[model samples]
Target: MIGRLNHVAIAVPDLNSAMAMYRETLGADVAEPFDQPEHGVTVVFITLPNTKIELIHPLGDDSPINNFLAKNPDGGIHHMCYEVGDIIAARDQLIANGARVLGNGEPKIGAHGKPVLFLHPKDFNGTLIELEQV
Candidate 1:
């Protein structure tokens, strides 16, 4: 039902500045940015020892990240992701524990082809949590 942190998603106003800061300033070797049309986000990923970091900016107003950045202009933490052996099982368990699912009742392709889903932030003190199966 639980595992180590997989990645932390961070909302950014500009992808270029965020990439430079994470890659050059923090010295995190990041992969090239990718556009996720499904999520309406363009993201760059930086892998870490225990967890990865995702720098994301909304591609449009309808994008979820747009609303996130609107409320959190400083580009704060957006979501915390944990690795799961089976996303469906984990999701069911989480739901039984009163966690509300945000996306469709199914896993979606995420960064690096990982299966991912979002849990409603309201159920976790305004912290959106993601379950991912590698």
Candidate 2:
């Protein structure tokens, strides 16, 4: 069951500049940056009462986030992640509803080490939807 608003992912070309803007201009308290070697992203997190705001940049050549940023280049919402109590159930629902999972199966570790899985944008009215269980 999806539970909460996990976070909104924003892919930017420059991580430092994005973090600075979110902290200085938006008055959001930036958290310690971390690298998800698997996804090839270095991310900074900003916690809100419900959902968090994630600023992400590529850390390597094969970075998924890098490809996303390159394609979009707007540094806007990359995906909307909703916290789920049961990722399996949530994914099942999508599958039954004719949605395809981005990967083979199971949720993978996303930013902040949260377990997450993505529904293909093609299946979700062109919106990349993520379900995460923290």
Candidate 3:
């Protein structure tokens, strides 16, 4: 089952501008940008008191963020990540409950370097959900 809210991911057209908004304007403690080639995104984490905000930009033309940005030029919230005690067990239970897992239905290393899986947006009331192992 899902645990605490891990982070909320937002796709941005310009990562630098987004970083400045969070760092300079909001005066938030933002981490340095990290390029996740495997995930096809360049990301930065804006640490909040209780959770984190992840600003992500497309890494390449084929990146999924590209399509997202194309659909909404201003960019917006892409997904919400929740923590899980056991990712494998959580995955099985979700699947048995008729929830569809994205991609190959296997866990992948997320931006936090933790095992993560994405569930279909339709299964979760139109919002994409990410389950990360705590």
- Top candidate, metric TM-score: 3
TM-score of 3: 0.97
Better of 1 and 2 by lDDT: 1
Error of 2 at 71 (Å): 2.3
Q: State how far residue 33 of model 3 sits from its true place (Å).
A: 0.5
Clashing pairs in 1: none
Q: What are the candidates' C-alpha RMSDs?
A: 1.4, 1.5, 0.8
Clashes of each: 0, 0, 0
Better TM-score candidate (2, 3): 3
TM-score rank, highest first?
Answer: 3, 1, 2
Our model 3 lands, by Cα RMSD against the true structure, at 0.8
lDDT of 1 by residue, 1-134 (tens): 76888888888887888888888999998888888888888988888876789888887668987777878887888899988999888988988988899867789998768889888989989899988896
The best-first sequence of candidates by lDDT reads 3, 1, 2
The residue pairs found clashing in candidate 3 are none
